[model samples]
Target chain A: METVVQQLLNAAQLGAVYALIALGYSMVYGVIRLINFAHGDIFMVGGFAGLLLALRFTWMPLWALMPLAMLLTALLGVAIERVAYRRLRQAQRMSLVITALGVGIFLENLVRLGVGPETRQIPSRMPTTPVAWLQDALGVSVTWDKLLIIFVSLALMALLWAVVHRTLLGTAMRAVADDKDVVPLMGVNLNRVIAVTFAIGSALAAAGGVFFGQAYSLDPYMGIDLGWKAFIAAVIGGIGSIEGAVLGSFLLAGVEVLTVAYLSSNLKNGIAFGLLILLLLIWPSGLLGRPASKKV
Target chain B: MSLLRLEQVSVAYGAIRALHGVDLEVREGEIVSLLGANGAGKSTILRAVSRMLPLQGGDILLGGRSVRATPAHELVALGVAHVPEGRGIFPSLTVQENLALATWTRRERRHVEEATRRVFRLFPRLAERRTQAGGTLSGGEQQMLAVGRALMTGCRLLLLDEPSMGLSPLLVREVFRAFQEINAEGTTLLLVEQNAHMALKIAHRGCVLENGRIVLEGPAAELAGHPRVREAYLGEAGASSPPCPGTPGSSR
Candidate 1:
């Protein structure tokens, strides 16, 4: 019973990370209609930024590290957009896709050049002492690390919801997604909105990176596999929907974790993609997207 | 004084010119009709005035100042509201949200309050569907919503392209009557229409465009009585058409 509870808790933690990274992928895709292939590298950059913050700013509390890291990561995102995505805004989708792939490669190489290619650890700043909680109403022991991860994940998602639904920028972002050509008609510069999208998406990816570094040791190539996984999560959720991405991430994360635990031990990533393919066969627009409308 | 003027304005798409060197004017508080057949460049004139289309060789003056290079959204601040071809209403937004977007730059919350009241007064059907998505509105209702959305911009120069298009005869008359009311309230209007007879009836002055050039220009009553205009637009036989030059537009 304890093992089952522990397994469920593990799945939830991994799911939380997937959800964060997936949101970034989905958001950037929603506005630009591009997959932002560099998004996983964005995660790596964020994780590194968080590590720098932790190492450099020892005075700041552990909780403050997230907001600070988000700020830095958002700035990095805007810079990346200005350099990489800006020129290709009106280019063909394939061109943008290749550009994004270039960005990801550049980011991985840059990280390798900046820091050695060895596995790195984020020095734990917070208490890691396990606090136990009841699971499944069966009084099974569930650890604090899992609960903490879940709590932070929910809080971040809630914050994201508020930013998306309540703010002027959010409205502008949704407007961009709906019709980019009409944005200037609404007195909004499309470039600025696109920049903001990159900023927000990258910032979120960074937060995911930070949490990931804390939970597991970081590597220069950490973003590559995680990034692909998150992209799959975004696809399964519906690439343009916030709720769909989150829900899809949780489902995908659960499938992967449980497959490793109970099913074929080495077929973890394989099972996730298999689920994605099944979803595509059934509903190609993903679980939440509106069906495509034909122009008369 | 004229609030808007087109001084030999010309527009081209690729190598194809849609508007030839055409001179036109709109007074500060009058209804001016641009009467044409489809492809006569009537919509192009409105597009030029709104700065949606670039002028190939001439100047569009708004209140005596050249507006050839002014951006589209800036014209809204200058009191030019363009109800573009196909309405261009945001389909995802609700009626109220569309109206709010029109007034996004407005101050005097009271003015917005008053505008909302006035819009509801003008379009009660719109009020009935204020919360509904714009895509679901019927053709006539969408026109009303389009007009209502334009009104929220506090524009003085209202450029309407084919307001009477796709509406029923009854709704058409109702839409024209609403324009009459709007004109009475002191907004300048540039009305573009393919239905020349209806257009001439409401216009203080009318310009007849053929193949991208203004072939005739005068008071609406005079142009309405012109033999060629009467022959082509009223679907009656002209002097060139028959034994009588005086036979056309005598009914108007």
Candidate 2:
């Protein structure tokens, strides 16, 4: 029973990180229908940005460090849009997809050259003594680190939901998603809305990067695999729907955790793609994606 | 001064020329109708004014300021609201949200509120179904919502492209009546339509376009009675004797 409970906690922590990365994928797809294959590289960029900030300001609070990294990463996302995606707005979808892969490669190699390819551990800012205290009090191994991660992730999701549903910028985002040409007729600038979407998505990815760095060591190639897994999470949840991304992340996380705990440790990483293929075969639109409608 | 003036404006869709030096003018507080058949380039002229399609030659002046370099969205702030063909209503948005989006470029909240109230008064059916999704509205209601959204921008000029398309005759009449009411409240209108009869009925001046050039232009009554316009546009074989050769509108 304790083993099952511990695995559940682990799944929740892992799922939160995946959800943050998946949101970046889902949001960019939602507004522009771009797969943003380079999003995982943005996550790596955020992790590196956070690591540099941590090194420069060793006395800075985690709260300050996280947001500063997120801000810089968001700016990087906007720069990517301006320099790379802007000219290709009217290009074919296939061309955009190919360009995205090129961007992913560009970001990965750029970081490898600048920072070297060595894996680096982020100094732990969170106290681990709480895990012992909680385990002693509850007679079950409940860690404060996992709980804090889950709490922060849920809070960010709630904030994002409010901004998307209640704000004017959110409405503009949805309007552009529905019809890009007609949105300009309403006096909403298409490029600005798209840039804002990229910024927000990248910021979320940065937050995920910071959290992931705290839990696991960072390497230039780390985002390549984790980013793909989060993308699978976004797809399983329905690529364009925000709620579906979070739900899919948790679901994939649960599957992997359970597989490692009971089924086989060897099957841990393979479970995400395996489940995605099975779910897609049964429900092609993902779990919560709106069914494709005919264009009028 | 004219509210909008198109001087020697030309447009091409790749290899095919859509408009050939189309010269037109809309004076402030006047309804000027551009009447034509399907390929007459009536929609193309409106697209040029809205800055949707780039002009290959000539210039469009809105309130004496040239709009040739302006982007499409900036035209709305410059007091030109275009209701493009097929009612460019954002279907997934609610009727109220659609109206709200029109006020996006407006700087003052008080002005936006005032404009929104005016639109609701102009079309009360929109108010009754304000919360409903725009897609779910009936054909007539969607047309009203489209025009209402244009009004929300507090525009000095309204450019409509085939507003009567696909609407029932009764709804068509209703929409035309709303156009008159909106114009009476001090907004200038430039209407593009294949329905020459209805368009002429409401317009003060009318121009006929055939094969991308203006073939006739005069007061609405004069164009309505012009022999070539009558035959080609109104689809009528006239029994009345033709007007005298030197009559006011005949020579041009």
Candidate 3:
């Protein structure tokens, strides 16, 4: 039971981060219907941004650094959209995919030029002091780090829900997803809405990057695997729904963590990917999505 | 003076020209019903004015300035809002969000809230289902939501495409009545409909389209009483204006 409890906490902690990253994937897909291959590296750049900030400005509160990282990465996301995506906005998905791939290669190579393709420590962004919890009932003492991860993640999710549901910008986003062509008729500037979408989505992923750096290790390649996993989660949870992204992340994380604990540690990734393949084979629409039906 | 004009506008889908040299206009503050059979380039005019399609040639002018080459997104700034067929309400969005999306440029939260209330008053059904997802709404409610969404845009000029399609007679009456109320409030409406009788009944003026051209156009009452329109369009509304079979099988 203790082992199971430990695995559950581990899964939740990891799932929280995946949920954040998956939002980026899901939102971009919702608005543009593009895979956005560079999205994974946006997280990478965010971690690096946090890393650089941590190195240069050590005195600021840890909380400040996290948001700053998100802001920085969001700005970069906008820049990437401007440079790579803007021209391709009118292009076919296939053309956009190719451009996205090229951008990914460019970002990876750009990072290589500066940071040189090496693994680095995220540095302890949170305090090392442990906070004990639920040892008596669940027999698993949750650390402050994991607790912060879970609490902050849930908080971010709540905030996102409010902004998206309460604000006009959120409506524009939903409408834009439904029909990008008609929004301009409502007097909305499509370019501005799209920029804001990319900003918010990338910013969310950046927060996830900061969490990921603390929860795991930092590597350029880290975003690739994590990005792929999050995409699978987005697909599994229903690609366009934000709730679906979060739910899917938790499910994928639960499976992966449980496999790591009971099943072969080496087979952890294989199990995750295996489940994704099986899922897509059965339900291509994701768990929460209704298959598209339209009157011609 | 016309509020909207299409001067020899041509729209093409690849090699096939959907609208070739189509000319149309909407006078200021007038409810003009554009009537046509399917594929008679009825929708093509709206699409061109809304600039949703790539214009192959010719020009569209709103308020006498050319808009043919303008981006589709900028049309909203020109005070033109299109209520596309199928409502196009964001299925995943709640009723409030669908309304709120209309105020993107309004910026002031107060006006946004006020517009929400106004739209709610106009569409009490939407107000009742304020928290409901748009996907869950009935067809009538969805159409109401679409009209409400357009109202949120604050555009004085509205282009409605097939607003009465797929609606029952009762719902259709309700929709046309609401459109009348809207037009009464100083908003200009250009309505496209398969329900020509209902459209002409509400409209101040009307135009008849066939095979991508305007065959007849005049005051709503005059056009309603016209023999050809009476035979082809108004009979569906149970109006005994003309015999059902014109010349016994005249290529309907």
Candidate 4:
């Protein structure tokens, strides 16, 4: 029973990180309808940004360091949209997609050259001590860092949900997602809404990067693998839905963690990909995605 | 001064020019109907005025200031609201949310609520379905929601494209009556319509557009009785008279 509980904690921690990254994928896709192949690279950039900030400001607290890194990464995201994506908006879908891939490649190379190909960890800021209550009650070992990561991520998700569902800016974002051309008719600036979307998406991904860097190690190419996993999570949950992305992340993490625990670790990717294919066959629009209802 | 004036305005869709040197004016507190066949540049004129389309020549003036350089989104704050063809309401949004979105320029909470209450007062059918998704509404209700959404912008000038399209005759009369009320409350209207008979009846002045140019312009009554308009637009075949010269093919 303790073992089961510990594995669940592990799954939750990993899922939190995935959800952070998956949300960016979902939001950018929601507003622009672009798959944004460069998103994983942006996640990589975020991790690196956190690492650099941690190294420079050794006295900074986790709360302060994380937000600063997020702000920096958010600016990078807006710049990417302005310089790379905005001009190609009216062009063919294929062009936008190819451009995204190119941007991803450029980010990867820039980081690899600047930071070197060696893997490095962000100096740990979260408490490593096991929670006394959990250890006493459940007879399981769960560290404060893991608990903090999970709780912080959940809080961020909640805040995001409120912004999207309750706020005026968020409503404008949904309006853009619903019918982009008609959004300006409502006196909402379409470009400003889109830029804000990118900023929020990137900021969340940066938070994920900071957590991941502290928990694991960061290499420049780490984004390629983890980003794909998060993208899959977003897709399985429904690419354009915030709730779907969170649900998909936890579900995907649970599956992966269980597969490695009960079965061969080598079969993890095979099973995860297979689950995506099977789920899509049954529900082609992902778990939470509304079926296309565009009026003619 | 005219509420809107289009002076020698021209618009092009790539290589094809949709409007060519068209000059027109809508005085304040007047309903000016732009009557045209399909592709006669009626919608194009509205698009240019709302800054949705770039002008290749000439300028559009709103209250004596040239609006040629203004972005499309800012035009709403400038008190120009356009209801495009096909009732452009966000289908997934509830009727209340749809109206709330148009008040983006209005920062005060009380003002937004006031504007919303006024819209609900204007269209009580919309008020009944305030929480219902816009897509679920009937065609006439969707039209009401679209116009109501426009009113929430506190616009002084309302530009409508085919407000009568795809509605039953009864619904058409109901919407036109609402427009009369909206105008009566001090809004100027530029109405584009293929339903020429209803448009002429509501309009104070009318202009006939053909092949991207104004072919006829006069009081609504004069255009309604003109032989060419009667034969081409009103579907009234002149008895014992030859086909009116330059009569275009029937509008779809």
TM-score of each: 0.89, 0.94, 0.87, 0.97
True contacts kept of each: 0.13, 0.60, 0.79, 0.72
DockQ for the candidates, in order: 0.30, 0.64, 0.56, 0.81
Task: Please give the distance, in angstroms, between residue A164's alpha carbon in candidate 1 and its true position after superposition.
Answer: 3.4
**Candidate 4 structure quality by residue, lDDT tens digits, A1-296:** 99889989889989999999999999999999998888888888899999998898899998999999899999999999999999999999999999999999999999999999999999999899999999999999999999999999999999999999888888888888888988998899999999999999999999999999988889888888888999999999999999999999999999998899989899998988898888889888889988866577
- Writing each residue's lDDT as its tens digit, candidate 3 over B82-119 gives 89866777777788777777776565878777768777
Candidate lDDT scores, in order, read 0.82, 0.87, 0.82, 0.91
TM-score for chain B of each model, two decimals? 0.92, 0.92, 0.90, 0.94
Model 3 misses residue B244 by how many Å?
A: 19
Off by over 4 Å in 4: B238-252
| Highest-scoring model, TM-score | 4
Clashing pairs in 1: none
lDDT of 2 by residue, A178-281 (tens): 77788888888888999999999999999888888888878888889989989999999999889999999999999998998899989887776889999999
Chain A alone, TM-score for each of the models? 0.94, 0.96, 0.96, 0.99
Q: What is the lDDT for A77 in model 3?
A: 90
lDDT of 1 by residue, B1-252 (tens): 989988998898777788779888889999999876667778888888888777898898889898788887777878888887677667766788767767755747898899999899988999999989777899899899888888887889898999988999999888888888899999988999877778889889998877788988999999988888888777766334422333222111
With candidate 4 superimposed using the best TM-score fit, by how many Å does residue A98's alpha carbon deviate from the native? Answer: 0.9
Error of 3 at B232 (Å): 5.1
Worst lDDT window (10 residues) for model 3 chain B? B243-252
Off by over 4 Å in 3: A1-5, A132-143, A278-284, A292-296, B68-70, B107-124, B225-252
Clash pairs for candidate 3: A184-B73, A187-B76
